[model samples]
Target: MSEPDVSKVLRLFKEEVKVINVGLEYFYKELRKQGVNAAHVIWQPKPELEKDLEDILKKIL
Candidate 1:
């Protein structure tokens, strides 16, 4: 709820995704240790952000 907790949760999500991509079990474990909840932190698509992200992806591709 607080700023630092929100930041930590966000950071953990990124680390978890990286772990998942490389199949790093320990990193995933560490993310859980930091009290990151996947349901809470994993991004959900919003209309505006989703559009922006799609644009960015198109550019990258």
Candidate 2:
């Protein structure tokens, strides 16, 4: 729509925006530089869980 939704816009302007950046330090830094709340989580797959096994686990779980 051309015009913004009033309530949504008001909440955005009034509330603090939060962001969780996983596996990307750049995005977290940029978000902080822009003054938004940000948390960076470093993540990696388990060493024993190979790609094929991981895929099967995803299907089963």
Candidate 2 off by > 4 Å = 1-14, 49-61
Q: TM-score for every candidate vs. truth? A: 0.26, 0.51
Worst 10 residues of 1 by lDDT: 16-25
**In lDDT terms, how accurate is model 2?**
0.88
Error of 2 at 49 (Å): 4.5
Residue 18 displacement in candidate 1 (angstroms)? 12
lDDT (CA) per prediction: 0.58, 0.88
Q: Per-residue lDDT tens digits of candidate 1, residues 27-48?
A: 5567677765432234445556
TM-score of 1: 0.26
| Candidate 1 clashes between residue pairs 3 or more apart in a chain or in different chains | none
TM-score between model 2 and native: 0.51
User: Tens digit of lDDT per residue, candidate 2, span 1-61?
Assistant: 5976599878878888888999879988999999988899998875787789999999999
